[model samples]
Target: MKIDREKLHSPFVEQVERVSGEVFANCYQCGNCTGGCPVSFAMDYGPSQIIRLLQLGQEQLVATANSMWLCVGCLQCYSRCPKGVSAASILEALRQMTLRKGEDHEDVGGLPFPFLKDAPQQAIISGFRKFVS
Candidate 1:
């Protein structure tokens, strides 16, 4: 629960700031993102919590959280946020950080749904391949 901010370093934070400075920096921990998140029940840390963690440079929490990969990218929290924080985009950035660090979700991989078989999954996979390749 405690982040050693001195240890955190990454260029991706700059990318997040560039793309979502208003929303990412304006978060007041109102928990609105978590309240509006349709998939909060399925996440280890809700959307707002992730943002708070990231703000504190808690890269371990963000990198290790399985919820980063669980995000459906529905953008519900982004659309509903009063602060205009794109919760979904924040989740995506966390997911990218996790992947860049080689964090893997073995449990998610064992799920019955084949990511390639689902259209949304396919789209995500395609996008990831494009971005990470």
Candidate 2:
């Protein structure tokens, strides 16, 4: 986690803000979002950590992480955020950014059909909508 501050600039951070309309910088690294996230155990970084990374100007690191897909549009983080940061929407925006570039962070294509066959309909649709080329 050695961030070369000189290399920190715009691009991804600006897009996150522009897309999610959430000022992630206002986040105070509180654990509320992470504690409230139902899928935090499966995520490499939780909702609060995501905001922390964004605030630290590690937008690319956050964007490339697999944690974004773990948010199943659950608004618990958003609801619990004292700073009004929409953590779910920010993750959604990351997914949107990845999708817009014809890429996927979750690698759904790597999973076999049978592995995903029993997945919920909502999850399948959401995955497709976010990852399909």
Candidate lDDT scores, in order, read 0.69, 0.81
Cα displacement (angstroms), candidate 1, residue 3, comes to 4.4
Residue 22, candidate 2: C-alpha displacement in angstroms: 0.7
lDDT per residue (tens digit) for residues 1-133 in model 2: 6566643446777788899998876888878988998999999889888887887788667876788876888799989988888899988888888788887555766887886888888978876776665
Candidate No. with top lDDT: 2
Among all windows of 10 consecutive residues in model 1, the one with the lowest summed lDDT is 5-14
Clashing pairs in 2: none
lDDT of 1 by residue, 47-127 (tens): 888887667777667666766667777888888788888878777765565556665544444545665466586776665
Give the clash total for candidate 1.
Answer: 0
Clashes of each: 0, 0
User: Could you estimate the TM-score for every candidate?
Assistant: 0.67, 0.81
